[model samples]
Target: MNERRRGPVLIELEDGPDTDARQGPAEAPREPGPSPADAPAIDDPDGPLPRPRTMEMVTRLIGRPPSRLTRIFINSGVALFAFLLSIAALDFLNGLLNSYPLLGWIGIALFAVFTLAALGMAWREYRAWARFARIDAIQRRAGSALAEGSLDQARQATRDLLAIYHKRPEMEWAAKRLAEHQAEAVDAQSLLTMAETELMAQLDQEARREIEAAARTVAAATALIPLALADVAAALAANLRMIRRMAEIYGGRAGAVGGWRLARTVMTHLVATGAVAAGDDLIHTVAGGGVLAKLSRRFGEGVVNGALTARVGIAAMEVCRPLPFIAQPRPKVGNLVTRGLRGLFD
Candidate 1:
């Protein structure tokens, strides 16, 4: 039964030999694939996420319904289709057209117009979706690649960025800037690879120098450690409890000062001392820090020690004559306070 009611018409087909049944709700007419909004619900009884539907198909497949504008176009199309069918169904049109003047061709013309309009609307939907699907695919791949942190991500991001580039007419400005950024990022990665290779090929003289220097500084600190510890231990003696506590503290301090085993402990202590930067792990703590930063504190300190040592060495040579000066005793705050309080008397 067909009638022109200026509204949507729904056709129902029941489960028979022609239609598969025994399932969930009535399946919407199977489109090419599921749309994102209608993507299948997936969970891990064991593991593994559900697969994603392409974005374009996502809406159509899942009834991830398109916009009202889309509805407008689609409804328009359906309306046009029905309009044409109505004219064709009207058998009186042939005779009416034969009898009437301009009126004769009117039905035929409406039929042609509505037919073309329906086709155009359907085509627009498909075209918009195909474009969106391609772009969405590239984006999904790009996101996955980046998250994977593989070199492949570099390739995918670049491609996705390019795909996004061509997607819009107004995107030329964004595309140009992004292209420059991608180029720079790719170049930087390449340089890092090459530099790493060269550093390795040389057998890591730099690593050797830093590690060796740390080993030496630890040794030197250990050598002086006994004297420093003894001084602290002597003052805390008499009180056995205090003596034990002081010994443990200084012992840990001395051991960790340069001991390879306690490198982390010592560095932690030093930074906490607030003599240097306020931080826990310097690399993570420092905003906008770079590769050299990735090294642990112990290693960084080793390199820094080398630089400082060089500076000290240069200064040592220029220190031929200490600035001639008379030794001034350190101010005695206790004595000063006593004298001041003794009353200003002859």
Candidate 2:
């Protein structure tokens, strides 16, 4: 039994230099991996990314003019629809009159009221277009005066400017100053410059305030509102209001239809001039790319929207202004954004 025992046997090996040499050299001790603390920090998961360019896209869509065929079709459709609607309404009214005299009278009265309202709206639109034309005339006169150095043209432009602002109480002081100093200006350039210094300065400040307010509104809406297309709508509405206010400040006094028209004009100019893209780069540079990198994506988008709004505001200023910037420098997007977005990110 002892000879045949199937018990487990154990073998022990001793460590030796010869044994170590036989085995391939032990892997060089791995250098300790850098501590987590030593590792470079990652950006915040919520940190800013590239702007969505929602506003810019919207601007382009609105700015692009319809083709002639499209315009014709739209016009024809609108006219046909209106005609059909009118015919239907009249047929309904006649039937009502035959069946229910009292109700028909009421309907007639309602129709009359609607007609008057339509007339009023048309009148207002007419006035708005006239105001825009007047602004254009003043700008042309100012340009001509400067180019030709014609004192008479300058004086005439000044007079038109005065006439435009005479009704506003805010302009009384500036108008007085302009009238007083304008006489001292011997040359066309000097007179217009003086007028700009006195009259335009106030308007410019007001316009800037409007732009800042609109920018703030757009930025806030873009950052906070998560709903799709909400930011675009807000941006469009804010821009429309801003453009309308600009027109009023510069004496365009645009009505609802006219305001939309003016906004289209501004967006068209911006798209054509490539200012929209340029403005984006300018804003990124001025705001410091790092600042946006520290912000959340939505917040970064908001900053960009606000900056583009400032650009639109500036363009609106150029369009609505009765005179081109001369005595005062055109407001820079960088400066405006810097001032406008103050405390927003902080």
Candidate 3:
């Protein structure tokens, strides 16, 4: 057998007219295509618009007032339940007394304890409402004083403010300073402004800290929590706590029910003013225009939620503060967000 052609065979073919063997004019080296980082992002006709449904839902739930029918139903149900509960309790006590004397005595003691607790709670509720009333009265007086330039009314308002903050050791110096210089104020506006500058400056700082904390919590929850409605719940809770703190900072010292009421009031104000929704202007102002592109969807939502929370906190401050923001500038949502979320994203 012919030692099988072990060597490799080469075949040659003629090149077609289009197949240039020699490199022709080096096709003007295609300018290196833009890099992913440097290339302009393709503009989508339909942008990924942010939907802050969490804050929206929370605000709506808090802000919307109960309908008359709903209120009636709730009130009637509570009354009926209380009446039935009392009857049942009495029957239970009678049975226990007839059968087990010792248990009956124990039950009586428990009932007494419960009654005392209820009474105490009622008293606290009353006091909370009274405090709220006092704040409202102060606001009205301050507004009237400023409007009418009534120095007397201004002095009254200042006294009320001083009384509210009198127990706060941190406020002692501020109170003293106000008392000393308040007399120098010639008009109502001047007097109130002086009081605000002296007293509210510290309170304002504290309230801002509260707002920033709430914003941070809300942002973190929105960004990290994956469960449905969890972020909404967290945001609502944070706002409620923040509002309550705001009230306390401004000397409202709201109780449980009062705090909830104050939160509702703040939410109502926000909803009425259409501040619940975070717009592009707000996002750009707070986190800059590229935040959405640089961050994930959750992060973007977080930023928006945090900004809305700051807005709610500001509203709460306004509602809770006895004096209007006449002397001190109101806290801005952008500034609060920046401070609150400073290292969060980084």
Highest lDDT, which number?
3
Residue 16 lDDT in model 3?
Answer: 44
In terms of TM-score, which candidate is stronger, 1 or 3? 3
TM-score, predicted candidate 3 vs. hidden true structure: 0.83
TM-score of each: 0.29, 0.81, 0.83
lDDT of 2 by residue, 1-346 (tens): 4687699988645454356555665455468887999877685554444565767666876687789999899999999998998899889999999999999989989988998999999998998899899889999999999999999999999999999887789899889878777889889988988989988998999999899888888878878999878888888888889999999888877887788788899987786777877554475543563366365667777777777888899989998998899979888776776777774655
Query: RMSD to native for every prediction?
Result: 44.4, 10.9, 10.3
- lDDT per residue for candidate 1 within 180-281, as digits (tens), equals 455444442342233223222222232223223322342233223345444223212211221122222211111211122122222233334442332332
State the lDDT at 177 in candidate 1. Answer: 53
Per the 3 Å backbone cut-off, how many clashing residue pairs does candidate 2 have? 0
lDDT of 3 by residue, 66-137 (tens): 999999999999999999998999899989999999999999899899999999998988888789889989
Alpha-carbon error at 182 in model 2, in Å? 2.2
Worst 10-residue lDDT window, candidate 1: 317-326
- The pairs that clash in candidate 2 are none
- Candidate closer to the true structure by lDDT (higher is better), 1 or 2: 2
